[model samples]
Target: MTSAGSAKKVVVLDYGFGNVRSAERALARAGADVEITRDYDTAMNADGLLVPGVGAFAACMEGLRAARGDWIVGRRLSGGRPVMGICVGMQILFAHGVEHGVASEGLDEWPGTVEPLKADIVPHMGWNTVEAPADSELFRGLDADERYYFVHSYAVHDWSLETANPAMRAPRVTWATHGAPFVAAVENGALWATQFHPEKSGDAGAHLLKNWIGTL
Candidate 1:
């Protein structure tokens, strides 16, 4: 953990697919010393690592692997280091993402499939509210009515990961609805993710980012 009064060092992994600059600005505003880089050493050494993504799931995964970001995330989680994903970044953490009738394998950190939302209107764009769990660290102190920015057509509609061990804490899953309910966010151990762009979500997003940074 960073010392009190010192900014946490956060790396926004630049693997050719995310809103890198936007995320950097937001994290900086949230009190972290942010760096935008794909350097393996720099990313692993940072107090917090954030993965941001936009566009197709397959393309993001391809870029991420080419940059060895998949290795970085897996390694970080092995040591219980903090890692967060935004937008399509969150999508690729699942087992598979089927976009445009093609299935691309994901990081599989969480078991599930990211499929197109069964919505009347595709790309559930604009602001929406989420049903955050009471014990969620990411949503801590935020109002229940607070909304976040979302711009995606694909989402994980079901969560299949369950704690096999009775003593282990279950993952905290947050939900939002378009034409139907889909995962909005998830918090499991050192790994955290959100389907919505907290960076673009305004004050509520800032608060959520601050909450994650505080834990770093």
Candidate 2:
């Protein structure tokens, strides 16, 4: 068993995005030596990085851009470091986000768009089970009926990811539905993201965070 002394050092990025302190606390509980910082160097050098966000995609992107969050993420990923994105932090990694007819550009790391959920209700709030892929390490040992917390109106509807590496393993993309199916979590190499707020998901969330830290 891995010891706490060997636990990964994780940095929760604070680019003025929402729920950072909670994320730091969650990662710490997950056995990571957590630090909450906006310092680019500290973020880039950490064994793992956590990016948490809330609110509109455009507002989150504005904050990310102002702090050059993309650069830090890109550089770390290029070096094979680990990074996990939560909620809008995950949303802004896509190509675009259309909220109220306003289309704002995203990080373009994935080929997709974030739009309103086609549900009877506006925001899909509460706990929901996710359908994870067979090869998923993030959901390892998690119960098949495990549920995560979610509170959002917008989500990525498209599930296509364009990659040229023919030998690459199929990216693990978890899905959950409100009115229609939407991305719940994605584990793609060095980049891992969850549309649900794992920090707010309680015990199940703690297990998920631990799983991600295991990868680091």
Candidate 3:
């Protein structure tokens, strides 16, 4: 465990998308020594890495590639380092994202497709509750009725990755619904992701961030 004087160092990847400044501030408040940068070495060396994303999946991927953020995430995960993704940052972790009928490739860290919500409303914005698993460290100590902020149209409606080896632990999946249920969060090994913006989710969000920071 790190000493109180040495807070966990976290990097909010500034890959030209998402609410970078807001994420940095939130992580700082969560007791992390936070830096917002696209520097490969700095990001790789951080105690935790947060990938924040906004806008379309294709555009986010484009920018991420330009900054080599994808490489950083892959390398970090290969070594069992902690990495987190928020909003579209979470979406792009999947294999593909189908937005407006255009299928774009994602990081492929997880096998899934991000498609538009089937709800009458296109973008499932605002606060909503999620069904997190009992063993979820991210949602630890949070109430079942606790809500988080979400602002997006596209999401992974189904989770298809099943653990091939019985001895290996399966990925913990969290679910939330609009017109239909979709993946709200995922904790798989070193990779963690949330479709909602914890930075925008008020006190519950703050608690969630603290939970993630604690894991770091």
lDDT of 2 at 128: 94
Q: Candidate 3: which pairs clash? A: none
> Which portions of model 1 show Cα errors greater than 4 Å?
1-4
Over 4 Å off, model 3 = 1-5
Write the residue-wise lDDT of candidate 1 on 1-216 in tens digits.
567788999999999998899999999999999999999999999999999999999999999999999999999999999999999999999999998899999999999999999899988999999999999999999999999999999999999887999798999999999999999999999999999999999999999999999989
For every model in order, what is the number of clashing pairs? 0, 0, 0
The numbered model that scores best in TM-score is 1
Sort by TM-score, best first: what order? 1, 3, 2
TM-score of 1: 0.98
Model 1: C-alpha RMSD to truth? Answer: 1.0
TM-score of each: 0.98, 0.95, 0.97
Candidate 1 weakest lDDT stretch, 10 residues:
1-10
- Cα lDDT, all candidates: 0.96, 0.90, 0.94
lDDT of 2 by residue, 42-82 (tens): 99888898988999899999999888898998898888888
lDDT of 3 by residue, 90-142 (tens): 99999999988999999999999999998999789899999999999999999
